[model samples]
Target: MGTVVDAPAVVTEKEVVAENMLGDKKVTVVFVLGGPGSGKGTQCSNIVEHFGFTHLSAGDLLRAEIKSGSENGTMIENMIKEGKIVPSEVTIKLLQQAMIKNENDKFLIDGFPRNEENRAAFENTKISPAFVLFFNCSEEEMERRLLGRNEGRVDDNIETIRKRFKVFVESSLPVIEYYDAKDKVKKIDAAKPIPEVFEDVKAIFAPYAKAT
Candidate 1:
């Protein structure tokens, strides 16, 4: 846990690209990786407000697909209820669409690149994050949070939550290791209070926080 770093109201793509080169902006795109109840959603919101970045949640994208009554809606709903990763192509299409539609350069991508395939697909297509913010918490804490979340969604049930947590551990660990090897992974102790966890997150991005 650390203090929040106030940032500029807007960050441009050029600035994002310039950061790594200039050694000033610590991160360009920040991939927020964590389990279903690991506070990735909550932290992304705070980061967006304080740091002025676009927050894209992959779950929200799939939920939108289900809501849109698209051709794949039924299948997506089933897959999500089963706590399974959606097809990379479909998921990447949604992510790409969101990225293209957004004008913000600094992005907080939540719940994406769930597995090695998803990570590879993104690497082959989209601009990679300058760094990744990983919210690390124990499985017990995640289960407690998800059960208490009370979202009433099918995916919030205990069975699905447990499945999703297992999927995350098995599939997402490699992505974390990959970023860790590159010295681009910022570890946040997510077991702490939400504000406290975000404090660490804000500090990690402080160097890149544009001064107003």
Candidate 2:
């Protein structure tokens, strides 16, 4: 018998947007990846203010979906509660919608593509990031920040934070590695204070700042 190979899985409607929609637009995207409590949201806010880029946090969008009582809200809430990743289809849809709705063409997408599947999905959809800003922080420091944040996030509890850390190390770190191998990762030490960290972030973003 001849050898046979399976066909690739069909791309979902969300994946089609991932592959084709953003690429067709004149958009510049920077992916902000980090362990939970690594200050991704904080630095992204600074980037938005200084560089004129829109800040799109995947987590925030999902939370908003939950609050809006979307059909997927219950499933997303459950996944979040378990410290599990939401499906890429759901996340990608939210991201695409946000990008289209916003007026700015430059965006800092924070806390997304949290696993290899996510990375692959985005890549397949044709959404290549300009670069990945990796917030490198020790687990001890991250744990301290999350515990002290007092933001009342359901996932801020120590147990859930630990699970998030584990997921980052196992799932998210590989995405950084993939970008690193391509010389497309800008690694930042997130253990420092906010001002010091943004100082470093500013340097990486200087060119974009000039363009804006």
Candidate 3:
């Protein structure tokens, strides 16, 4: 029997816009990735204000979906409780819906593509990120921040937080590496103070600054 060698799946980026439903409008995607307490939320807000980019956080969207008692709620809830990544289909659907309903052209998509499957699934959407904003922080610092957050999130406990960290390191870092190899990652040091951290993020986003 002849051996069948399937080539690895290559991710090709669509730089301008997403075709389906999004029409011909230019859609700029910046993937925001970090650990649980890496302060992705705060910095995303800053980028939105300064860059005119709409922020669509994947985690927040799923949480909202769960709260709405949708069909996926129980499943998502169980997976979250176990610190597992929700199915890419569920998350991707939410992202696409949000993008279609929004008025802005540029977007900062936070806390998504948690694994290679996620990265690959989003590629099918034909809307590739211009760059990946990576918030680099130590596990120690992240643990401290999550413990002090007091946000009442179910995944905020010490045990669940640790599991989330494991998932991030084992799964998410590879996604960052894939972008890095293509020179599409903008790495940021997140251990600094919020203002100082924004200084770095601001520089990266200066090219996208809104005219105000």
Root-mean-square deviation (CA) per prediction: 10.7, 5.8, 5.3
Kindly indicate the candidate among 1 and 3 with the higher TM-score: 3
Clash pairs, candidate 2, are 18-125, 19-125, 19-126
Flag clash pairs in model 3.
none
Number of the predicted model whose lDDT against the real structure is largest: 3
Instruction: Give the residue spans of candidate 1 off by over 4 A.
Output: 1-27, 69-85
Lowest lDDT block of 10, candidate 2: 1-10
Lowest lDDT 10-residue stretch of candidate 3: 5-14
In the range 117-212, model 1's lDDT, one tens digit per residue, is 888987755367778889999999999988887667777887888888888889999999998999989899999998899889888878768679
Best by TM-score: 3
lDDT of 1 at 51: 83
lDDT of 2 by residue, 1-212 (tens): 23333223344554655543463576888999999889888888899889899999887899999998878888899898999768898888889889988877888989888889998887755778989999999999999998998778887888998998998999999999999999999999999999999999999999888452
Residues 45-109, model 3: lDDT tens digits:
99988889999988789888899897788789989999976889889988888887898889889
lDDT of 3 at 47: 91
Model 2 C-alpha lDDT versus the unseen true structure? 0.86
TM-score of each: 0.76, 0.81, 0.81
Off by over 4 Å in 2: 1-24, 72-85, 210-212
